[model samples]
Target chain A: MTSDSSSTAGSPEENATSSSVSGATALQDVSEYSGADDDLQKEIQTAVENLECCQSEIESLNVKVAKEILKVKQNYNKIKKPIFDKRNEFIMKIPNFWLTSFMNHPEMSKIIDDVEKEVLQYLTKLEVEEFENINSGYRIKFYFNPNPFFKNEVLVKEFSLGASDQFVSESTQIDFRRGSKLRKRLRDYQKMISKAKKRSKKSEEALPRSFFNWFVENAEDSNDIAKYIKDDLWSSPLQYFLVSDV
Target chain B: MTSDSSSTAGSPEENATSSSVSGATALQDVSEYSGADDDLQKEIQTAVENLECCQSEIESLNVKVAKEILKVKQNYNKIKKPIFDKRNEFIMKIPNFWLTSFMNHPEMSKIIDDVEKEVLQYLTKLEVEEFENINSGYRIKFYFNPNPFFKNEVLVKEFSLGASDQFVSESTQIDFRRGSKLRKRLRDYQKMISKAKKRSKKSEEALPRSFFNWFVENAEDSNDIAKYIKDDLWSSPLQYFLVSDV
Candidate 1:
C-alpha cells in the first residue's frame, strides 16, 4: 500500500496513467496510507478548501455590504417620512403649487395655456432619485391625483446637473377625456414651445430653447407672495405662499 | 410736481435727501409726474421686486429638492424591506451558524470562550446609516434580542471604507449579572485581544490587530455551511453568531 501510494503520488498525470489501479485503493492511498504522499495530498486538499472558503467569505461580505446599504436607505426613509408627509399636507392645502410655479417661469409662460390655469392643481408628490457621482444628476417623478382635466397623472423629468446643458428631457403621457379642453390646450402648448424654440434660434441665442428653463425663469412672482411666504416651521414645505388661483 | 419728481429721481440718494417733502406730494410727484425719474423709480421698484422673487423661488426650489430626496429614500426603503425581512427569517432559523464559523477560524479560536459558545445565537437585525459623499462611509448598528448571557443587547461598529486603516472601532456596554460566568469570559476575551496585539507587535509583522478582522477571517467555513450560506436574498446582518446548547 505504501509503495502503491508513492507510485500513485508521482503526479496527477501518473495517477491517471495507473489504469490498473482500482478507484477505492487510490482514494484509500491518498486518505489513509502512511507516507509523505498522504501528507502532500492532505495539504493540497486543505489548500483547495481554504481557497473555496476565501471565495465564500468574500461573497458573504458582499451580501453583508448590500444588506448594510439597504439598512442605511431605510434609516434615511425613516428620518424623511414625517417631514415629507407634512410637506405633502401643506401642498395639498395650497392648490396649484407645482402648476403655478411651472407657469411662473419666463420660458414656460410662452408655451403654457393661460386657460389651463384654472384647471391646474397641486402635485400629490414629487420624488427625486439621485444616481450619485456616476451620473452626477437626478431624476424626478411628479405625481398628481386623477382629476377631471387630464388622464396622464405622472410627470417625469431627468436632469444632468453636471452638464453645461442641464436639461435632459421631461415626459408625461396624458390621457385626455373625450372633448376635454386640455386636449386642445395640450396641442396648442406643444406648438407654442416649437415656435418659441424656432423664434429663439433665429434671434441672437441660437441654443435650443429649454421649456424647463423658461418655466423656472417665468415662475417669478415677488410681491404679495414674497411677503406672505415668510420662512416658518423648518419642516412645513410652504415657507411662503404665492397668491394665485390658477 | 414734475420738476420735483425729476429732482428727486436724479438718484436713489436724492430721493432719500428730500425727506422734508410731504408724503402725499412725493407720492403724487412719483406716480403722476412726467419724465425718466418716474420711469426710473418704477423700473427700480420692479427690478427689486424681481430680485426678491428670484430669492424666494430659489428657497421654494430647495424645499422641493429636499422633499424629492425624502421621496427617493422612501422608495429605496420600500424596495428593500421585503428582501430584508426574508433574509432575517432565513437567518433566524439557522442556529449557531455564526458561532461555528467563528470557532472554525484559527485566529478567533484563540480568543472566543469555549463555555460561551453554548449561549451564543444569531443576530436579530443590522441597520446602516449613510453620510453620503461627505463622509462616504456607513455606520452599522446591530440588534440582538434580550438573552441570558449579558444585558447590553446592542453592539455598534463603524467602518471607514475609504481609509487605509479601515476599522474604526467596536463597542458594547455589557452589564453582567452577579456570579455570571460570562463576566469572566468577557474580561478574558478582552485580555486575550490586548495580549495578542502586544505579541503581534513584537514580532516582525507589526500590523495592527483588528477584532473585526478576526471575526471576518475566522467567520469563514468551507464545509456545508459555505454551501448553505449562498447569496440569494440580499439583506441579512453578518455579525457574531451564538453557539447552541453545550
Candidate 2:
C-alpha cells in the first residue's frame, strides 16, 4: 500500500514534531508541514497515502464481511425450506381440515343454526382459497359428495365480510332446487337476521347467535374475524367432516 | 454452485412418502423406496443429490465467512500500527522522561544517598532499547551529557529481575573515576542491602526501599518488579549517573 519512495523513517528530528500526529485525517493534512525540506515533504505525502490506503482497505473488508453474512443467511433459509415444505405435505393429507375447524369454533358454532349445521354435515370438502384481512376479501370453496338434491358437487363463494369497511358481497352461484337442504339453510339465515333486527329495541342489539349470522355480519371489517382464520389450533378438527354425510 | 443435473422436484406422488426428507444422510437411504417404480426411484435419487449439493454449498459459504473475518482483523491491526508508532515518537522526545519518573517514585527516593542524588541531577538522556519479560533478559540503555568525571557518556544494563529467577546483569562499560558519584551510588546500594540484612532479624526486613534497590533486588524474580518496568510511570532514573562527578 505504501507508494512513496521516501517513507517517514524514525529519527530524533522526526520524533520531535509533526510526526506525533497519527490519526488518518490528521495524517492526510500533509501540506501543513510547510517548513520541511523536499525529502521530508515526500515522506509526509507517503504517510498520508499509506493512511488512505489503510482506510480504503478497511472499507472493502467491511463490505466483504457484510456480503458473507448475507450469503450465510440465504443458505440457512434454503436448508430450512424443505423442512417447512415437508410439514405442509403432511398437513394437506387430512381431509376437510379447514371446514371442521370452522364448524367447531365456539363463536362459529353459536352463529350457525341447526338447519345449516345439518347441511354442513354433507360438506365433503371446505377450502379457504383466500382468507387474509387484505383488500381482496375472503374466497371460500366447498365440495360435496354426490347428493340427491344438488346437481353440482363443488360450491365456491366469496364474501367481503369482516375484511373491509365496505358492504359485504357474495359471489356464490346458489342454483340449488327449491326447498333442498342447502336452500332451506340459506333462507333461514336471512329470516333470522331480519326477525332479530325487528324484535330488538336497538339495531345494535341484533347480535349473531348462529354461524350464518356471523358470516354475514362479520364481513364489515377484517380485524377480529381475520385473526382467528390464521390460528393453528384448528388444524385437525375437520378429519371427520370429509367422510360424514347428512 | 450446484452441479446436480436432477434436482428435487416436488410432485404429488413424491410428496406422499418420506422422500421429502431433505437431510443428506437420510436422503442417502433411497434404496428403501425399492417398492416404488423406476421413475419414483430416480426422483428420490435426484432429491438426495439436491440435498447434498445444498449442504456442501453451505459448508463453502461458512469457510468464506471465516476467511472474511480474519481479513477484517488483519486490516484493523494495520490501521492501529501507525497510530502506535506516532505515539512512541512523541514519547521519545522527552529527555529524562523515564529517569525523572524513577527518581520521584516514593519507593526509589528513600534508597539513594545525598551524594548519589546530586550526581543524578546531571542526567541528560535515557532510553530503554528493550524491556520485555519474555525468554530473553531485559535490556536497558542510558545516555548522558559530558560531565566532570565520566569518560563514557552512555551506559547499558540488563536485568532478569521481576522476569525470572536469575541475577541482574549490567553490560555498561562503567569506567568512572574510582570514587566518582556513579561508583559511590553503586557501592552504597550493595552496602545498604548487606547492612540491612545484618541488622534485621529476618532477611525479609531488608526488602527494597528505593527504586534502585528495588530494581537491583527485584531482578531476582520478575513477579512485581517486571510489571512496573513495562509501565510508563518509571521513565529513566539512571541518566544522572552517566555524567555526575563525586
Candidate 3:
C-alpha cells in the first residue's frame, strides 16, 4: 500500500507543476533573485533537506505502527475464532442458511440469477479465512451438500496481496455434471458471444450474468464483493441471515 | 464512530426492507410452515441469538483494537516531536517559508486571494497540534509577524470531536487594523451584499473572497484544508516549501 507516506505526498513534483504557480515559474523567480533572496533560498533548501529527514523518520515509525496494528488485529481474530466457530455450528442447523444470508446481502443479491439462486439452495456453509498476515488477504469458501449441478462439495475463492499490494484472486474450478443447467446456459452464452464477434470484429464479449461466473472472473478492479463478504458478512453472518426476518 | 458494529449492521431492518424478498414475505412463508419447518425456525432463532452474542464479543474486542491503534499513533507522535521541532527551527530561517509552502499547496492556494497572498507574505510559522486523544481532533495555528494586515500574532483554528463525533471547529477572531486594506475590502463586499439583499429578498450573501476570512469562517463541511495541513504539510513542510524548486 506504499505505507501511507508516498500515498499522502502523491508525487510532490506532479503536485508542484499542477499548482497555480508552476515550479518552473517559481524557479524563474528564484533565478532572478537578489543576494538576500539567494541566501534565503539556500536556507530554505537546508530546511527542506531537514524536513525530508524528519519525514523519513516518520515513515519508519509508520511502518512500525502498521505492524503493531496488524498484531492487534491478529490477536482479536484469535479471540473471535471460537465464538465464530460456535456461531457457524448453530447456523448449519437451519436449512438454506448460507443461501438466505447471501440472498439478503445488498451486493450479493444483485448478481444472483434465478438459476444461481436454485443452485445456492444446496449451500450448507460459508467461511472466510483471512491470511495470517491479515494484510496479505483472505479466502472465502462455500460448502455445499450433494448437489446435481457440480461434483465438488466445496467451492473456494481466495484473494492474496500481489507483489504490488493489489488484491489478486483465484477460485476453485467447478466440475459441472453432464447436461447441468448452469453448464448448458454458459455454453449457449459463449456460442452467442462468438457468433456476435464473427459478425462484428469490434464486438466486445460480455461476462455472463450468473453468480458462478464470479469465481472465474478476475475482478481486480471491482473486488468490493469479496471485501463485503470478508469484512462484513464474515464478521456477522447472523445479521444477514436474519435480514429476511422483521 | 458508533463503534464498528453498528456501522456494519446498518439498521438490519432497513436492509431487510430493501432486499428483493421483503421480511414480511419471508415471515408469511414461515407462517405457513410445516411441523419440521417450525422446529427449524426455533433452532434458527437460537442460532441468531448465539451469533449476536459472538458479535457483541467481537465488538468489544474492536473497541480495544481502536484504543491500541490510538496508543501506537500517540507514541509515534511523541517520538516525532523533537525531529519536527528541529525542522521547524530550520524552516524559520527562510523568508516567506510558510507563505511559499501554502502557495505551492494545491488545495490551500485555491482559497487564497491576492490580498490574502500579501497578508500571508508576513506569515512566519505554521503549526498543527493534534489533540492528545488523537481522535478528539486537532488545532492549526498560523503565526505572523507584526504586519499591516491584522493585530493578532497568531491566528488559531481548533477542531474538536463533538458529542456525535462529528468535527466542529472554532477560529480566533481577527482584529483588523484601522482602514486596513482587507478590512476595507470586506466592508465594501458586505455593503454590496446588503444592497443586493435590499433589491432582492432572495439574494444569497456569498463569503468574502479573502484569506483572512478563513480564520472567521466555520469550515466543518470542508475541513480537508485543515486535514492536509495536519496530516500532510505538518509531517513534511519542506516538500511543499521546496515544491517551487526543480
Candidate 4:
C-alpha cells in the first residue's frame, strides 16, 4: 500500500484531494512544498508520504472489513444454515455479539428497523389492554418484553444453560479482553487525527471563506463554511433538524 | 392466555405452580410444581398453577423467538436480520431459563455442552494467546495457554455510518433498553421467592425434611434449593479470580 515514492505519498484521500484541486482552469497545481531549499522540499515530501501511508493503510483496513462482511454473508448459514433455512424458524435472529453490544449501548432503543417496528406492534396488540385512565378510558397495555439485562447498568438475560449450569461463550471472554485493543485503536485514531490536523493546514488554507464559495468548493468530508468560520460569520449553524417546521 | 376462574393472581408463575399441584399429574410432565401440596395444599396448588402458566408462556415465547429466527434465516440477505438471527437462534435452542438468567445468578458456568465449549474455546483462545509466552523460535508451539480477555476489561468499538452507506445494511442500534427489561424480570423473580417464603408456614409442613432431602438432591437452581431450605443454601458468590487461572 505504500507508494511513498510518489510526490505526495499521496494517500487515497490526498490523491483524491489533489485530483479535485488540479481541475481548476488556470491554477498551477503546486508540487506540495512551495518554497525553499531542495532538502526542505524532500523533508516535507517525506512527512506527506508517511501521512499518506497511514491513509493508505486505513483504506486497506476498510477494504478488509468490507471483504469480511461479504464473506460472512456468503457463508451466513454454514454452521446452522440448514436448520434455519426456512422462514418462521426463529422469531428473533439477532446475533449474540450485536445483541450484547445492543444491550450495553445507550442508543439501542431507537435502533428499530422497519421489520422490528412491525413485530413490536404485533406483540403490543397481544398485550392485555385496559383503561389506564379510568375516567377517559385511556387504554394501556404491556407485553412479554424481555427486561434488559442492564437495568441500572446491567441486564439480566437468562442463558438457556439451565439452573446450576453456567457457561461463558468465547465471544464473552473476548469481550472483556477487547479493552486494550480499544485503547490501542483510540491511540491510533488520535495519531491519525493529529496528523490530519497538521495536514489540514493546507486544506484549511484552501478553504474558501464565504458561504457561497464554501458550498461550491470541495473538501474531504465536506467541511463547509459554517464549520470553519467563526461564530459571527453566520447567523445560525448549519444542521439538520428533525420534526422542525422550517 | 389464562382462563381458569379458580386460579389465583400473584403472577403468571404463581398460577403455573398452583395448576401443577392441582391434579396436574394428568400431564405428568407439564408442571414443575407437581406434588407440592402435602401441606398448605390449596395455596401450593394455586402457586403451582401460576408457575405452569409462566413456563408455558416462556415456552411459547421461545417458540415465537424460534419463528423469528427462522424468518431472519430466510431473509439472511436482509441488512440486519442475519446478524440478529444468529445470536438469538442459539439461545432459544437451550433447555431452560436458568441458563438464560444473567442477573444475581449463581455459578452457572459449570455446565458445558460441545457447542458452548467451542464458543468458550473461541473466546478463550484470544485470551490464551495474549497471555501465552511465545518464544520467537517456536511460533507454532501450543502449550499451557492462558484464558484470554481476562487481562483486558475495557473495549471500544468504532461505528462508521459511512460504511453502512456503501454496504447493503447497517448494524442495528444497540439494545441497552433491554437491560431494564432483564432487570425487571429478575426483580420479579426475587418477589416470587419472597412470597414463596411468606407462605412457608404452610409450605414448610408440606415440604417436610424428607421432601427437602429429595428436593436438595433433585433441584438444580440455587434459588430453588434456597426456597426449600428457607435459607441461602445455594448462593455461589462471585469470586474474582486472578487472570492466570481464568
Candidate 5:
C-alpha cells in the first residue's frame, strides 16, 4: 500500500508562517511570546523534528501492519475457497439461483435494470476469484447458459490495484447477438446523449443505466460494484438469496 | 466482534415462500417449475443446507480473523508506544501545541466554536491513551492550565467497546468556575431549545454546536469524533499541523 508522503515535511519559512498564524490567533488570551525568545523557538523546532521522526517510525510500522492484514486475508481465503467451490456446485443445481441472488442483493439490485434482469435469467454461475497476492485485487466471472442476448458464455470483470494503489479494472467484451434488444437500446441511449452534448457544452458523460453497460464501461471508473460483489455478495450469497422472505 | 445472525437461516415454509416469490418474478421468462417436482425441490433444499453449512464455516473463520487483526493492532501499538511517549514529552514543551494541532485538523476545526477556541488556549497537553487490550477502547485526556473557564486540571473522555461490540463512552465531570461563560451559554441554549419545543411539537433535539458540548453531551452517541482523533489525528498530528501550508 502506498502511503501519503506529501505532508511529511515543510520548508522552514512555511513552518514559521504556520506557527505565527496559528500561534497569534490561538494564543492571544494566553501569555504573549516575545519574538526574542530564542530558547523556546529552538525547543519547538526540536519538538517538530521529534514528532516527524515518530511519524516515520509509525509509517514503517504501518507497512508491517498491511503485510499482516494481507496474510490474514490470504489465510482466510485459502480456508474459504474449497467451501465456496462446494457451495457453487450446489448453487449450480438450482434454477435461476444467480438471477434471484442478484435481485435480492440491495446494492446489486439497484444497478440492474429491466433489460439486465431479463438477461440475467440465463446466469448459471457467478464466481469471484481473488488474486494470489490478495492485495493486488480480484476478478468476477459470470457464466451463462445459452441465451438470446449474446454469444459469449462468460463475461468477466477483473479489478487490480495499480502501483500507486489505485483500483483499475478490465472487462470482457460481450458478443451481442444480431437484432439484440439490449444492443439497440444502448445505441439509442448513446445517440440521445450525443445529441444532448451537441446542444450543451457542459453536458455530462453518459451514465450506465444497465448492469451490462456498467460492466463493460470505464475500466478506470470507481470500483464500488466490484467491492460490493467481492466483499459482501460473494462471501455470503445465501444471505442475499434469502433476503426476499423478510 | 459480533456477527449478524439474522440472515443465517430461514424456516422451511419461509424458504419455500422465498423461492416461489423470487422464482415467479425473476424466472418468468425462463421455464416454469411445475411445483409437483418433488425431486427438484428436495435437491434445492439440500443445496440450501450445504450453502448454510458453508456460511457457518465462514462465520467461524471470521472469529479467527478478528483475533488475528487484534494481534496486529496490539503488535503495532507496542512498537509505537515508546516513540509516542517521547514525542509527547517534546509536545508538552511547546506552548499551544494541542490548540494549534486541533485548529489545523479539518474535522476538529469544524466542531470548534469561538468560545471553545478561547477556552482551548488554556489546553497544555492533549494525550490519547488506548486501553491495554487495544480492542477494548481508548481515552482522550486534556490537560489544562488554571483558567477562569474551569477549575479541573484535566478533563478525560473514555470510550469502551461493550460485550456485543458496541461503543460506549464515559466522561469526567467538568467543574465550571463561578461566572463561567460556557456554562451560561449552554443554559441559554437549552432554554431556547425548550421554548422552541413548547411552540412546535415537530422540533428536533438540539445538536451540539461546540466541541465542549460534543464532549460532555451523550456518551452513547456516534463515535465518529473519537475515531477521527484516534485513527487519523493522533497517528500523525504533524500531517494536519502542516495542512495549512499546502
Candidate 6:
C-alpha cells in the first residue's frame, strides 16, 4: 500500500511540474509576439512618414514647373500684346488691298473663284491662324479694280511678300478680325498664367533652402538682407535645394 | 690674511656663476626669436591661402550671375522671336498706307503742301528715333512742302495726335515705307541671340552645381555638366562666389 501511495505522489508531482513548464513557455510566446507587434508598428510609421515626404517633394516639383511655364507665358504676353495688335493691322489690309490688285490681270481673273474659296477656307476672322499659314513665296489671287469697279475680276499673282510689300501692287492682302474664340483663348491663357504665378509664390515659401543668404560675419539679421554690407546672394540657389532619400 | 683669502675666493665663485647665468639668458632669448620668425612665416602662408579663398568666391559669384542673366535672356528670346516678326510686318505698312489715305481725301488735299512739309521735318529713316517721338494730332500748311512740291511756306495742321497716333489714325494720312526696317531689326536680334547661346555653352561647364542638377536626371553631350556629376568636388564651387567679406 505504501509503494502504491509513493507512485501516485510521483505522478501528481510530475504532472504539476509539466503543467507549470508549459505555462511558462506560453507566457514567453505571448511576450515575444508583443515585441514583434511593436516593431511592426514602428516600421509602419516610418514607411508612412517616408511616403509623406515623397508626396510633398512631388507636389513642390509640380508647382515649380507650372510657375516657370507661367513666367515664360508672361514674358510672351509682354511681347505678344504688341505683336498681336500689330498683326491685326496688317491682316485687316489683306483683302482690301489684295482684292483691289487682283482685278487687273486677265490670266489671274480665271483663278479668282478658286483663290477666293482657298482664302475663305482659312479665313475665319482668326488672324493668327491665317498669318501663320501664309507661305512667303506662294501664289494667290490679287485684284486691282483701279476704276471704281466693285465687282471687278481678281488676278492670281505669285505673292512672296516679306514683312511689308511696300509698293501698291496687285498683291495678296489680308482682312483679319477679332473672333470670339480667339478672345476667349487669350483670356484663358492669361488666367492660367495668373494661377501659375500664385502657385509659384506658395512654392517659394515651401522651399526654405532657396532663400537669399547672408555671410557668417553679417548673420545678425539673416532674415533681412540689409544686415549684409553686400546684400547679394553668396551662391547659386541650387546648392541648397535638397531631395529627401527616395 | 687666511680670512681675507677665503672671502675673496668665495666672491670670485659667485661672480663666475652670475656671468654664466647672464650668458644663458641671452642665448635663450636668441633661440626664442628664431622660433618666432618661423611662426611669422606660417601666419603669412595662412593669410595668403585665405585671400585666395576669398578671390575664388568672388570669381564664382560673378560667373553664376552671368549665367543666370544669360538664361533669362534665352527665355526672352524664345518668346521675342515670333512676336517681333509679327510686329515688323504690321508696323512697316503704317507710313505709306496712312499717307495715301490722307492725301486721297478732298479735305486733306487742301493742306497737302503743309502735310508734306510736316512729314519731312519729322521723317527719319532711323526706326529707334521714329518710335520714340510722338506725333501731334494735326498740323497743316497751305504753302510749306518738302517733297519737291513747295519750297517755303507756313505749314500747319489742326489734328490732335498723341503717342499712339502712328498706331491709330486720327485725322491726316502720311506716306511712308514699312516692313524692311522691322525685318532688318529682327535679323539683327536673332544674331545677338545666337551669340548669347554660344556664351551660355561655354559657361555651362563652370558651374558644377548647375551642371550636376542639369545632367543628374537628363544626360546630354555637355561635357562640363557630365564632369560635375561624376567627379566629387572636394572644394565647393559656391565658396568662390562671395561678393565681399567683413
Best by lDDT: 5
lDDT of 4 at A165: 24
Q: Residue by residue across A91-155, what tens digits does model 3's lDDT show?
A: 78777777777888887887787888889899887888878987676788999989889899988
Name the 10 consecutive residues with the lowest summed lDDT in model 6 chain A.
A1-10
Off by over 4 Å in 3: A1-45, A163-165, A183-214, A244-246, B1-38, B163-165, B178-221, B244-246
RMSD of each: 24.6, 26.1, 8.1, 30.9, 8.6, 48.4
Per-candidate DockQ versus the true complex? 0.02, 0.02, 0.28, 0.01, 0.32, 0.01
Task: Report the C-alpha lDDT of model 2 over A1-246, residue by residue, as the tens digit.
Answer: 111122222212111122222345444444445577778666656644443344344344445544543344345445544543443343334333344555546445445566665655556554444333222345555666566445667765454433223334454454576568756665666787578878985756744455443343333432234334322212222222222221
TM-score for candidate 6, residues paired by index? 0.17
DockQ ranking, best first = 5, 3, 2, 1, 4, 6
Evaluate candidate 1 and give its CAPRI docking class based on DockQ: incorrect
Which residue pairs clash in candidate 3? none
| Model 1 lDDT tens row, A19-109 | 1223343344334223447556565344333323333443444444334443443454455545444444544433354565455443434
Ranked by lDDT, top first: 5, 3, 2, 1, 6, 4
Could you tell me how far off, in angstroms, the CA of residue B206 lies in candidate 1 after the best superposition? Answer: 63
Q: Write the per-residue lDDT of candidate 2 for residues B1-246, one digit (tens) a residue.
A: 111122222211111222122454444454556787888667656644553454344344444544443354345435544544443343344334344445555444445556546555555444444333222334555555676546667765564432222334545556677557656666676787677767885645534354344434433332244334433222212221121211
Better of 1 and 6 by TM-score: 1
User: Better model by lDDT, 2 or 5?
Assistant: 5
Candidate 4, which segments miss by more than 4 Å at Cα? A1-38, A50-54, A78-81, A85-246, B1-246
What docking tier does model 4 reach?
Answer: incorrect
Best by TM-score: 5
lDDT scores in order: 0.39, 0.44, 0.65, 0.25, 0.67, 0.28
Residue B54 in candidate 3 has what lDDT? Answer: 62
Question: What is the C-alpha interface RMSD of model 4?
Answer: 24.9
Name the weakest run of 10 consecutive residues (lDDT summed) in model 1 chain B: B1-10
